[model samples]
Target: MSEAGVSLEMSKGSAPLTPVLSANWGDPRAWKLVNYERRGGYQGLRTALAMSPDEVISLVKDAGLRGRGGAGFPAGLKWSFIPKDNPNPTYLVVNCDESEPGTCKDMPLLMASPHTLVEGAIIASYAVHAKMAFLYVRGEVLHIIRRLQQAVAEAYAAGYLGTDILGSGYDLDIMVHAGAGAYICGEETALLDSLEGRRGQPRLRPPFPAVAGLYASPTVVNNAETISSVPAIVAHGKDWFQAMGTEKSAGFTLYSLSGHVARPGQYEAPLGITLHQLLDISGGMRAGHRLKFFTPGGSSTPMFSAAEIDVPLDYESVAGAGSIPGHQGPAVLRRDHLGGAHRDPLDRVLQARVLRQVHPLPGGHLVAGPDAAQDRGRRGGARRRRQDARRQRPDRRQILLHPGRRRRRMHPRRGEELPGRVRGRLPRRPGMAAAALRAQHGLRPRGLPRRGRGLLR
Candidate 1:
């Protein structure tokens, strides 16, 4: 095993913080190729170059490395999906378009150590037999783009890239592409379309990227952190990588901590670490404030309240806790941050955007039931009777605002119980919930081509 040059910090029996991708971030001039190589950087690529591509793919497969991107798909399995018999050239595309709100990990990683991704892309491309790879970054991030370009240039100069890399017969070329700052290109298929100079919108699936991708050839698209993780896995071996995270979601990853916290930045740790633990280690919330709500992944993931601080920040655990673990990291918001009278107008706008981006509503099961309509009518009738009784008493009741009380109400005609956090937050009218259900069921048809035949060219 090669030296990792990373140090793990632990406090007695508390949760430990393991830094791999971010290990050298604090080092002086860490982005330079010379500085990166001095710290056991491209040793993974060296080790990978010695093995057959299949063996390399199998190594990563056994390591249990999941994608750091929002979906958390298995990384090695994605690589193996490329068809061996296909005559078309294979390609590897790294998604550096960190356009999602609160997704801060990739841009910082590129700025701090662009070579990590460069080396990883080369290794991944080799594994999938891709001769070309593209780093599609958001065009608005000019500094990140320049840094990646410099890193690619340095890799070529050092013979870690280009033809006949490091005395091995394998050859690869990495191109840094700057996308026109479209948020939708963060989606893999849409990113591919944008890479080909088309409108950035999601392409239909089934013939997924592995089957038909960039230029209609086979491609393996991975997030920046997902690809950057490859180098350490190659150098350190499967067992070493698997030893850090849980059995299913193995390996260390960078978590971007921001919003209403004392220390907000990137904290690399094993999967399954809790938000409570993260907040504790990061100096907790801002002074005199308490955690109100947070997005476990980003605004794209469902909101988890302060009650869910202990939820494990892993793929399965976070999903189990009603949120998604992703590279967007946890954006913590305290009570005062949202409820203060002096809150900035920009903050209000951001809150609205966050609400809009949260993962789509829970399925129709929340409102659909055999006797749902009947049960809702009965409840509404009982409430009306009680109101009539109160009105006849001639007693005036003082209405007081209770912050702890449920502020919103559900539709009167719906009976099924919703999740605790979502219980009374919907509209109280009779048909709103049903309308939402209709909209949910209509989503599929909306996504289908309007021609009513098949996918349009």
Candidate 2:
């Protein structure tokens, strides 16, 4: 039997079919709900809904499905992580934040088959006992957001979502949330924090969200592709799912070929497929551009040179190649003649601020304190009294006042001159010339020359 539910029917001399996920991507309306339903979509949900949640989990576990979100943890094991006795609501969060520099599969999948995702969401939620699900998509993709919203509406209308889904007594609500476009937010905990209307930054993971997540409830977070793969597992039996790929890694995965590739797009094949095989199917590298380097997953994953292209796309095999297969795709980077590279100036200033924060003050305090505030005020008053006496002191300009504290070497543009503070030789800007000066010294202006002819004079 073929891996994907359908059997491989090859023509006289043609290669076997590449399977359904990617086979019809080129179709104009490939993303339309009608086209997907016609192609045997939602069959998995119907099969999944009929089975008990434990049975569904067992099927996926036996199928050998692993997390497709870089970590490659067993999907079944992840679902099992949710506490059975938790009284709080359980959640299924779809990590659609495809912001990994080279990872593009989630966005395309959402663009093409929004319902496939909705269906998977329902099935996954059912298996994990989640009453609600959240699709955390990257904010940059407005088009995808609009498409998904419409898809959710369609699913609700069709009784695939909301209460009493297909008379199975399972109720699910899916909310498509657009993130504020932060890369760190893709980290599961950070994604939750951002979802809760806080800054997107990684939180210490020990609670791991499986125990305390999203509003402090048990949450099962899986990548979009991982969840999307559920429908097939549900429709097809576990043995059928296990028929494809290697022992550790089973099922078909979508590989996104981008950058220098001739036909760059999603390629659906069993997990262990090699990069060479993908290149062959996608029509290989562009005309004359040779692959100099490539990222196995995205920028976050260590970069891999062309020497490792033959590595299997599976997590184990790719890990052996000294790079994590965060996503099974080749972000080919070819040599090109471009303008000079310039670093962001704000980065330097931020670095300096961080360094200063880490350094110990004169009194051995790692941070400035109230004493520093009094000292700053006293120094300011003394400086004003001795204005003519300290004309030659260039260091007099370096005082900064923050909330409840003050420090020397203030940021050059922080506009920190207190009411009694004496003026210094630093070029003044409105509000905070000292902070601006510090930023300028840190090359915070991206090497651009500051305005005004006074410096030239």
Candidate 3:
């Protein structure tokens, strides 16, 4: 191979911190192409390049890698749905518009090891016979978009992308798109609408993206984490990926844990990992507080209690426990004593990862919690005026805060952020947990189109 073909200098990367998805996160040069190649990165794409697309798809199906996105569908099965005989060109659209309340994995993956995603995208596009792939990122995350763009440039420069890649006679191009800051766009159909420069909204289904998507052509849409896993699966072979996790849900995955814990961060382990194991490994509840309520995925997922701590965190187990393992992460909160936590000014603590507004009648059985909207008439006119003034901004911090026992030991102080921090939660090494304020959606299939006609991918 010519020196200009690929530049893998003497750069080195650290072994993953006992993490499957984040093995190269700690490496200072992990974002660079040379560093990526040094750690056996793009080799997956090369491996895929050697196999027929069908074989590649079968390998993933055999590995049993479920989607990291909330829906938990089989990744390979989703890919296999794209029609090979279609007359129009097929496309690969990556859902990177990560705006979930308690989720934060893809952004950090892009930041720490962007080339992993770029290589994975190339391989996925090739497997589906797609000549083009598009990554849809949220407009607010400009830095993440830049990082990914740089990775694509590096891949093209290394001859790992574009026409005649690595003398394999394959061609592919990747485009990075930024969407307007809308949480709803995290939905696949809305994301597709936004991608087409139309208003972002959900579409009907039946003709899912795999059949008729983006530009009315067959498309395969997957989130960043799902596609990022493809490289490892393609490189390591089916058994290597399946060796760790259970039979139904094979391979290691990214899990984000937050709230009042001794340590809270991203934990990448096999599918059936239990929260008891996570809490035991980390320092357990913050300041040694006992667990109270926790959301296994996000607010959208039903919350579980302390009694179910030992439940294995897999699709099957979580479902049996009355909650969907929509995503494998959990946001844990400790019981709070309302009186002391908030003083005269009404100090509040946000214990859960995502706290959506819930209003209750004056004396109803399901009254809102401390973090919920409080009684406005409690204070005199002046105090109410001050409260109204503060409410003007009503930023996330103010809204997230809830009256609780005077501060215990919270990792991230209230009002310290604008909702983001999965990177903080990622344990670069084993036996560590990260406390983070916020982090990080789901994709839907087309059963029918609603707004105009069909659903988005």
Candidate 4:
């Protein structure tokens, strides 16, 4: 009736919650460096410079700042994980890939206050004893990328990002790398692989990025929101940070609102803020519409019914309600669309745009007929030849021996390995199947060749 029900605990809190990082989101030119400087944006970098790197790490640890990324790992704890004696250069990678559906906070944050992120990067790099930092952004957001590049240039121009910042002898260089968009890359290991110029895919973790990451060096990979929150934690002491939010989940976060809500935007509040409180700030569901199920954090997080609205939006509490906060926020739906009866207007428009670009194939699969397959093969073969020719340059003889030896080794295994290798190499080729390769190798269909029996010895 009254937007939604506010939690009794939130209503009972006597102290006012402070929203530091997101305090200026509503202001015009909120993203500009001039506006940010006027509001004491880079002040944290100044404070961070004066303190010892260990001291900065201690303050963050004392602040109880957990990761704003999906994992919620302690930010300070993550920094401390890097070995102090290690000679390898430590790195701080800010994950700016806001590809998670309904997660729009980082992009707007960058578009508005790229310096805040840059300043935060400088501070974070200092805390982790990193001399170099990289902000890996989503590739498709070219405008934001340009804005960030400009912001980095400004920081370098001001001597805030380069050597001996504020005469503290702490040097940091920031690089903005645009990712070829992939959802899996948001995962820390996958993000590292993408940063390394490879196709984005999740890597097994154990030797998590804290130990071996980014050129096989100790690295700290944090979400954009997580690193952006560092400046505020440094400016305001750790206790000031710990004072807000719950015990395990300390500090404020930006909650993005979209879909059927009367108002849709970012709301900066403490971690435990409930959906009801958010709805109150966002102007509730659209007019006469009622609440249906909602995703707690984008499509990856599990959905919650209207009855679970009071669950606190912290990592622990929301997880207790059968969802994780992650980087995204809840998508409120007015009715169930399980039967494909309805779709979001944005989704429909996107679908139409995609459909316009490519002809729909039977059963929604892209079809490649003989002609198309032949064209693809020719193009692929031509590209391979060009690459091989480049590698065959006379001046490149130093690396040629390595390639030759690899080819020779692989060739020796071709008889017994041809089936497996052919299947792996030409998985999509129509006529050049693994069975054909096996037959060409003179190997039996299900057993080894007569000569292979003696070779096995």
Clashes of each: 0, 14, 25, 1
Give me the displacement of residue 64 in model 3, in angstroms: 0.8
lDDT of 2 by residue, 372-427 (tens): 33435534676543642344121121221111222333332356333344456744
lDDT of 2: 0.68
Candidate 4 residue pairs in backbone clash = 31-112
Report residue 159 deviation for candidate 3 (angstroms). Answer: 1.2
Once fitted onto the true fold, the runs of candidate 2 whose alpha carbons sit more than 4 angstroms away are 1-17, 23-28, 335-457
Task: Rank candidates by lDDT, best first.
Answer: 1, 4, 3, 2
TM-score of each: 0.74, 0.70, 0.72, 0.74
Q: State the lDDT of candidate 4 residue by residue for 206-312, as single tens digits.
A: 45688888877899999998899999889989887777788888888888877788888887777787787788766788887788767667644556678888788
Clashing pairs in 1: none
- For TM-score, the strongest prediction is 1
Cα lDDT, all candidates: 0.72, 0.68, 0.68, 0.70
* C-alpha positional error of residue 454 in candidate 2 after TM-score superposition, expressed in Å: 51
Every model: Cα RMSD to truth? 11.5, 15.8, 15.5, 14.2
TM-score, predicted candidate 1 vs. hidden true structure: 0.74
Question: How would you encode candidate 3's per-residue C-alpha lDDT over 358-417 as one tens digit per residue?
Answer: 111111112112332233343445675566456532222211222222112222345544
Residue 36, candidate 2: how far off, in angstroms? 2.9
Among all windows of 10 consecutive residues in model 2, the one with the lowest summed lDDT is 337-346
